[model samples]
Target: MDLSKYLGLFVSEGGEHAEQMARELLQLEGAAVAPEAIDSIFRHAHSIKGMAASMEFSEITELAHAAESLVGALRPPRAGSVPRATVDALMAAAERIAVLIRERGRGQQGEGKDLTLLLRGRAADPWSEPVAEAIPLKVEPAVSLRDRLRTVRVRGETLDELLDVAGELLLETSRLRELARQAREPLRAALDESVDRMHSRLRTLHQRVVAARLTPLSVLTDQLPRHLRDIAHQLGREVELSVAGAEVEVDRAIVDEIADALLHLLRNCIDHGIEPPAEREAAGKPRAGRLRVEARRERERLILEVADDGRGFDTKKLRAGAVRRGLLSIAAAEELSDQESLMLACLPGLSTSDRVTEISGRGVGMDAVKNAIEGLGGTLAIESTPLEGTRFVLRLPLNVALIQVLLAEVEREVIALPISKVLAAIEIPSGHGRTFEFQGDEAPVYSLGSLLEWKEIAAGSAAGRPVLVVDGGGKPVGLAVDRLVGQHEALLQPLAGPLGQFPGLSAVTLLGSGRPVFVLDVPRLLEA
Candidate 1:
């Protein structure tokens, strides 16, 4: 039978086996030898070698065979203990197999000679080249940042400065269009069309600049497994860390901004939540605690959750601790809801540990984590149950450069409100009162033109007018407009130079008709 039809199955199964091999190797380090673990790995490697040999992939067959021998040498009837070097070499071989499997998945040929020699005790020096470096990962030559980074390093600031100048020049062209509008109607229309064509090109350039700055979440999470292993070793704890959805890409600036926050949260989980191996066994749980880091995309936002199956602290204790530490008075602590009390853990100088350690328990880690997330226009939430578990959730924009905006017409001037911040959009009938009932309470509504006072226009006696329910810092507020212009995807371009002087506007965008529209910073506008 021809083996060509089984290519996909072999690659998929080979990948899973390699992953199991890596995890088993990680378990062997800093722990007692287990013949069962070695046996399981040997079986997986043997299966891979058999499949590769059937498929006539000699390079992969040789690599898997070498790794199988290494694992077999550490099993019973031959050895009683596992050598550290064997585990290291086997781990490298597993890494090589994983790379080779990925190449098979992508229809590429990869050579694993260096790692195969290192595994079978033939190479003079094992560390001369890493498995990841043996065969370079393929990437498209054009537009791939991997190719560009290999030759040159560019700073994000320099990119932003160039974009700002380009944006300013675009605005200057808009000013010139105003002069053209004063000429004859025929000549004015021709000039407007030319400007529109020019604007289209500039917008494409702006989009490229924005995309070039995006960083993959994998870049941020690539070293997480090794980092978690090192931290577990330091804390003298047994933790199994698993990560998911590391392929999502986001603004590089957001990645840099939240890197420390992610680290602090991870450190907190290991330092405080997980119990010692003996304590965990006594508590009727597994000796090793489970820690999960997951990232997923929902609409326009990236939701990141870090959860741990360990002993969670009590919010009652947090409330009492707040009172004891003098961070809050007795009455204030009593009035706080359980969720609010849970957040008090982020307060400086408030820690659950009885003694301070270098890893955490100084009380500043959570505070910094919260602040960093909030600085990126994201919210951080905490949920825990006593003696059960704790989960920290971060909800942030997937792309800060682009936003889904609700376009509305106010006195004939188009405006936008970020959809992420809007609660709902509704229609009001004619003869309705100024106060609309929402959630059993009356929410005061005002016309958008009345609030912004632009051209002193209003939607008086009009029916089917649009009203937006916006989040006004915990409470909802109603803002009605003359008409609904529907929703649109827009780039939140910078307002530089003369355009920067416009108050109460967060960003601006150009419509398909070449008309410029401003985004209302609703809270700021209301405050002013």
Candidate 2:
């Protein structure tokens, strides 16, 4: 039998089991040894070992066997509570297993390292003695034939192709509808009805396909506790990670793009935000610092927050750092509010750390995190109070592939604005169009014609011109357009090659009539 066919299955199942084991080990490190947790760990290790052995992956099999032995020793009721030393050893073994699995998946064999010494050193204790057999007894040779999952994994590229075809169909349907509008009465009615039905069905199908590509944020976040545990241990600090809204689902593409940003934020929380246990205690706070990561969906956007209850941003230090680093003049730095001074942390190569450390102090990570979030059509903001805590809030689009846009004409060109950012569109009176009362505050309004430097279609009269009230970085701004072309379900195709560098525009889309329109980056446009 050609066992190569099972490669994908083995890697997928084995990877999942490894991740599960790592999470359980982190839990075991904190809580007293539960029979159930140990049993769960044993089963995962056994499964990986069997799968690896069947595939003739000797290194993986050996490592898994070692981990399995350590876990098995704890299974017996006579075995006392697990030691922190044992947990550390298993975590190391699990991390190595994860690395090897990824390497093998990429068709590269890992360089084997003898982990037996490490495993035996931790596993040998009063609870159990090391097995003296030179060669350990093997369990079942064949892999487990379990059918638990009802779903199959599809490659992202395949899904993208499906979406592209759907987009083309929608465009063609719209063209047919336009042609139907020009037909003779009786035939036109029939064609119009049919085209409308097709359009509705296509829209539904497109939505379903897009939803299928969404995975819960938990998929990326569940493994973070293990990382935090390792980092906290290394830094000699006690910190608790509490995650909420892990169940929130986002586009797989968005998840992939923000994974690194999320990691960096978590690292910063540990390294910079959370103080050491001794310091926390000295400050009359709990010995263990708390870090919270929460994700929630609001309207068409996903909001993620990473917060730490520790020593908050010291604005004075930040302002001094900014001035010293030449990011801001001493006079300007002194003039900044505490909030503005705190924002300086996002400036590149600016750190408030007294000395360099392995994890941070090179002053590189936070700015990259902000850039990564913004690159995904998102905005990142910071909030902190001295001696209280710090929170980083990221607002991101729910899906990058498809978006609801308000189509409008500017400078005789059709432009798209994300509907999520538009609060309302209203017709403004001629003279009153210069400014609008928003939340009891006067906000200056600018017409697209004036902003784009195009000759106004109705230069003298603005009696019936549409003004879009938009949330511009938390403040309302009015944007006037020549005409409100109405709402559209647009397939956002990212600009490629040289055009990708263009500012004030994130993507372009083709209307059902085959007319291409640029999708404006409303925030960037407002700033400009």
* Number of the top lDDT candidate: 2
Candidate 2 regions exceeding 4 Å error are 1-157, 172-193, 435-444, 451-461, 471-477, 494-505, 512-516, 523-528
> Lowest-scoring 10 consecutive residues by lDDT in candidate 1?
122-131
* lDDT of candidate 1 over 410-523, digit per residue (tens): 888889998766777877667664766666666667777767553322434323677888866656677888777877556566566675545567678875456778988676
lDDT of 1: 0.74
**Model 2 score (lDDT):** 0.79
List per-candidate RMSD values in Å: 18.6, 19.5
TM-score of 1: 0.56
- Candidate 1 at residue 214, lDDT? 70
